[model samples]
Target: MPEHRSATTPRPAAPGAAAPAAGRGGAPGRLLVRVRERIQETAEAVSLVLDAELPYAPGQFLTVRIPGGGARCYSLASSPHTGEPMRITVKRVPGGLGSGWVCDAVAPGDVLEVLPPAGAFTPGPGGLDRDLLLVAGGSGITPVLSLAKSALAAGRGRVALLYANRDPDSVIFREELRELAGEHPGRFTVLHWLESLQGLPTAAGLGAPLAPYAGREAWLCGPGPLMDAAGTALRAAGAEAGRIHRERYFSLGADVFAQPAAPEPPAEAGVEAGAEPAAEAEVELDGRTYRLPWRRGTPLLDVLLAAGAPAPYSCREGACSACCCRVLEGGVTMARNEVLDDADLADGYVLACQALPLTDRVRIGYA
Candidate 1:
């Protein structure tokens, strides 16, 4: 019988002879950043810079967490090349908890926790060597400005920016964008759109046909209706579907149009108005179950936190999917879900921040 090779024998390494260590999967990176400066961009909007180095892509965003209040997502408005400092522009929504904290309580030298960058809105490879068109409304100019700055810094010259705001004073990064336009000369074009301009033309009135940049990539970000209008017009004017990218801000007004109608509850499961339930509900999260007092009309998230369960969450308005969790058992009614796709929802994924427990017991996990 022929001698059999030992199956358990380890292979020998080459001259370098180094072994690879196990990779840490999905570990969170935290940064402590102090506010370096803050400027009022508008009556309700402000731009802030941090004395910290945050490595991030052009269109990526950071989650700004306040001490007592929750966190909110803000797009990075400055380029990485600026070095050692990161800047983000924020627009305070009326009655917003996070916005009010950042505007009123946050000050220079105040330190805050910043999560690592996360987003899928960055520019693509096809954007290379093509004339770039950017359309922004209100505070949506943040990410667009970052992309433009990155492209210019990389020596990718052909670019144009069309920024729209309520008025000239509300335009974020006004001086910096103007300086960039001046530096690039004919290469960069900026169209300022003001709804209240007495004699000036609006973005819709710009007679310049989009045919000149037929093969160009277009980026749009703003309020839902404005972004929709700009995207529709760009497509109608011959911009390719694959080349047009967009991002939308959270809007209570647009939620009606953006969200699908919620499913109605069964007659047998009707909740009594102004009457506290006899018993509290329990939700199982991360191997621990917490009981929450059954308060009428209380959101599921509030109940979870009140019961001492640490659930991951950002942008409690239900727009961002950061707090997404999978329902293992039972049902929940979502007030709104702007981030999850149909396939995700079908897979039992739900935004824990927006969900209301429809039953006495629900099981969820941060899968």
Candidate 2:
């Protein structure tokens, strides 16, 4: 029998790989994990392995807190079943505090605090028996790869990936993906769409390649446009909305695609005259109600968390809906949003990390 360690180990494994029967998931107050190692994946990406053993579903992400530098979320690229160090691949964002630190500063033995795994894209919605179509762009390959290994390993389902990158040298996990394909033979397939050779890859461009798996269930992660394009293409090819899942690395405010924020116009006189004062908030978590201080520039999630509320939040940047809550009364506005769609918006769901109250008093509930 393989020796089992006393603590959580995150190594590479398929999603279907077995894990310890019981383990503690690093909840909010317990986010500390020691960095075991850092493996360079590409010119811009590095994978960090943690010493702690925390069980998390595949496709979920951990909120990484850098002591005084605040927190950011990154999806776990390796499966929890590996019984090795838990691994999260970080792509260096040119000016990002979290990504920059992960890629440049973190090393063997370094420790970082990370919130528990949170996300809803894991397997079982359609079960592991159905065919799986994996789509990704740029660094978005992180979670898709995890999902791929999971689908393939879980039920021996056929898996195909359509990965888009800038050039041949830009792909993260290139060799590993190739090896997986080689190992799986007819069951796994991968195709690369390089911008240098074929221009930017879009959903419409995927029509021909995706035709074979038109009815297959798909999961996608990438920049906004890439995700939109892929989603459109998948829909055009007859994939049902129910069978497709999507997530973004950055919200529109953060610009996952690097599209610059438009220049702001000069402020006119009396700009504040009609501008309303900050909104007071009444937040409910687990049947407890607390009055929230609406700080001028603080995220609602931070406010709630600091107030001792078990406000679930990962990636306060508004991309992931880990902090999503039901709006009970009054109104709110998001600085940027990438998670909830029009229907969700109409239904009054808002990401607390991204939302700012618009009315004098806003009420939000976790349920």
lDDT of 1 by residue, 1-367 (tens): 0000000001111111111112211222334677889878767777788776544556656665555534567787887544526788777767776677777777887876765444434553434356788777777888788878877776465887777677777777789888998988888888787867833433355436344554677777776576666666676677767566766454222222122222222222335665545234555554566655544355555556555454544455666554556677777778887766566577787776588767666666542
lDDT per residue for candidate 2 within 1-367, as digits (tens), equals 0000000111111221212222233433335667878899888889987786665656667666654445566777886534445678888877777788778888997767655556555564445567888888877887777777766676667998999899998899999899889888999999899989988877678788877886887877777687788778888988887667776444323322121111222122224566445567787765578886565444577667566565655555666676667788998888877667776678787887777767767888764
- Clash pairs for candidate 2: 8-53, 9-84, 10-84, 10-85, 10-86, 15-150, 31-114
lDDT of each: 0.59, 0.66
Error of 1 at 363 (Å): 27
Screening candidate 1 with a backbone cut-off below 3 angstroms (N, C-alpha, C), the clashing residue pairs are none
**Residue 23, candidate 1: alpha-carbon lDDT:** 21
Worst 10 residues of 1 by lDDT: 1-10
